[model samples]
Target: MGLSPVLWQFLVHWLHASALFPAEASGIAPYVDALYFFLVAMTIFGTTFVAILLLVFSVRYRREKNPVATQIEGSTLLEATWTIIPLAIFLVTFVWGALLYFRIYDPPTNAMNIYIVGKQWMWKAEHPGGQHEINALHVPTGKPIQLTMISQDVFHSFSIPDFRIKREVIPGRYSTVWFEATQVGTYHLFCTQYCGTQHSGMIGEVTVMTPGDYKKWLEQSNSGQSLAQNGERLFASMGCNSCHNGTAAARGPSLAGVYGSKLTLTDGRQILVDDAYLRNAILNPSEHVTAGFAPIMPTYQGQISEDGLIDLVEFIKNMQSNYRVQQTLVTATSGEAAPTTPSEGTTETVKP
Candidate 1:
């Protein structure tokens, strides 16, 4: 049967233009939805056109009306018209998709950075101010938020359908996704990948607040130490300063101003130091050993948490010749984090 008005309505309704329409919370959502609708419209048009031609040919070539079958010559012009039109349409679609992809993946230089770690059955979010949340992420509206995520266990997908953003969080690697919230409301966050038995329960909420409210929340939710501070503490506690001290006696490469610097590996490969490179160097040191140093740095594969690794990365990125490690009581015991109180004990400072 030919596609009727009822079929057209069904196609449109099934795509969730009504109750199931996703909220356009981020700046990229409207454009994403527009592209999706254009694709759906094209699909519907192609189906309708094919159905009409089928019905037309069936009625016109009926045996009762023409007794004998006749062969028709193929028209080069008709063939060329169909081929070139579909080719042009496909090229346009590809260009549109590629542009949107770049827009979604490239974060602005000043975007707010937030670190996310996913493990079996739960998600942990850490802010630069040291604020930590188990299942909820709070961000300010009208500001670009960039999330650097990693999976502590199996692979997981961090998804926020309202923002039209999703990225796969892989173990031993970092994944980044950014979005600028345009609305002040709460949206759903989910792990779209199945990890274990409790995968379904690995869900959370993302709260988008006004800039002022977000500032107030940040002030109130202070974790007593900034991420950089924690990184500084961890830096000394882990004895990282012994090798990365930037001194003549140091055995390993100095990390001062090395975050974005180009360095050559022992194997004659050159690489630019970035977040991923830092992470890999920390967890898998032998892979990117510096040209003049031995690969004696032990891998911190299971010794450090993802959040702590992020802290170390931040510290290294901002490290200068004058930077020093701020040793607190927490550095005394690397096994656990000591309580931060009104009376912060004596701190020891060591230069890089």
Candidate 2:
């Protein structure tokens, strides 16, 4: 069956252009569509109205018809109508756009977090399941996913046009963006900021799949250690356990419950401890020292790689609630003995 005449006409007349070809797959897409179409319609109307008036006045007041040039002051009613109408339109779009902006920037509670590292020529994504991908992202449809992105070098922008979300990936600082996909499909992911020579090649796909399919894909990858587990390993190996593990001789504060908490710095300024704060604490310890703590931690700016730093951050995040380290002993299907972290309130038991 074909679409109804009215529906077909609406599609053809309103959305057949390039502005509407991209499907709305995220919560913010509809807002973008409305703002875009409203501007397009206004532009068309203004152009047509001005063109018609010019043509009519040129013929009506031509030198052959009216020899004397009539000079007159402008009409207050016409002037007020045009000025107030455009001002009102501008104000409405501005307010509407601001609301949509906040909706995209605010991360919802319980949203799955993903870390992204944008280098000179590629986009690297680190999932909590220890699955890492270069130039690609896999997410479950209909779930809100929050991305913490930072650049390894210059400024870069992570953008998904279909989702109508884009944010700057700044170097040495973290920026975040969030979106909830409504459809299951593959969409284009691009770096809108020009980094260097291979900027054009820094494009990839975001695959949105069903929850079941995403789970299957994670299992198939067989990543022995979760992101937090790997981070924990890195944490222990790097001697971070010496000071941050709640010891009397330790100089740094215990990071166990620091994530998402408001921290008071030595300078009397309070800051929220988020992904960016953690990253900075590791890379530049002197920047924001916690109150009552000496700045003894060495800066790891060039010593640690981006992936390693991400793992460290994840480990810190998981420490908030004694996060389980899911280590598969044998394949779940085969039922072999694999080492796994003890769940909260559960005793560790080993099978022969």
Candidate 3:
């Protein structure tokens, strides 16, 4: 009991994190600290052992001690021992690190989802309940929260020191990171990458609260609808329903039950329907042309905002798990039937 405080002080000092970053407030923090401490201890021991050997050899084998030089011969046993021991230690380190890497990257199925978009100098986080926060995220303790992140402009890294987790948000692609807060407190959020002129100011805070408090916080900020609900409205406004109405004669393939499923592309390559693939198919329909469909859809690169795109993706992902499309669409916002135009009926298709 008496040594507890001293050990705690030593650990805090050795990590060099306790002063700046908060105490371990995440499930993975302790594990990360353990691995880091182990490596540091090994390094210190190796350095001290080598220094001691050098000093002892210099004094014991000095010129005056023997007055005669003797030929030194290599010992195979000693050489083998040194080589094998280091190799074993390295292998152990590798395996331990690999397991931890997977555990950190691969989120559990029960984890909650949060979408984050990184721009030039700020972070945008969106919750399922339609709560939006800029540069600040609120989450509950004890529940796993998975962050699906992407960059809107230059590359940015989302780092939280207290959580011992960081992930790069790159443009044109998605990156994911997850953590479970073990304590309720505020932690620092930083963009480790130097993004732009205001990179230093690109900082935020993660407010972790008790489960009850988190629920209340969300309720207070909830926008009265879900992301998927908003996406459904946006999808209608975009005139996608005119082609992807999920009918027999509909030009586009049915999106129901298509997410996470495999489908072949027009280029004879099979690909899984994921968030990245869906986003690309929507923005660059011609490039990701469907197998049977003609490549006639125009690009929507500038038409839809990033937030709109995210909502649409969520809608498609949650649409018809057991197969459901509440209503069929015939007209876009223009209220004109697109399929009736027999000539040059080329349009966007979200096939498979």
Comparing 2 and 3 by TM-score, which wins?
Answer: 3
| Residue 255 accuracy (lDDT) in model 3 | 84
Q: List the residue pairs that clash in candidate 1.
A: none
Ranking by TM-score: 3, 1, 2
Q: Note the clash tally of each candidate.
A: 0, 1, 0
Off by over 4 Å in 1: 1-17, 325-352
lDDT tens per residue, model 2, 37-138: 667767877898899999999999999999999888789999999899989988988998788777778989979999999998999998988998999999
Q: Write the per-residue lDDT of candidate 3 for residues 80-146, one digit (tens) a residue.
A: 9999988997998899899899999999989999999999889999998899999999999999999
Residue 302 of model 3 has an lDDT of: 84
Clashes of 2: 1
Higher-scoring candidate on TM-score, 1 or 2: 1
lDDT for each candidate structure: 0.84, 0.80, 0.83
Ranking by lDDT: 1, 3, 2
Worst 10 contiguous positions by lDDT, candidate 2: 343-352
Candidate 2 has a TM-score of 0.84
Q: How much is the lDDT of residue 189 in candidate 2?
A: 98
lDDT tens digits, residue span 163-219, model 1 = 999999999899999999999999999999988899999999999999999999889
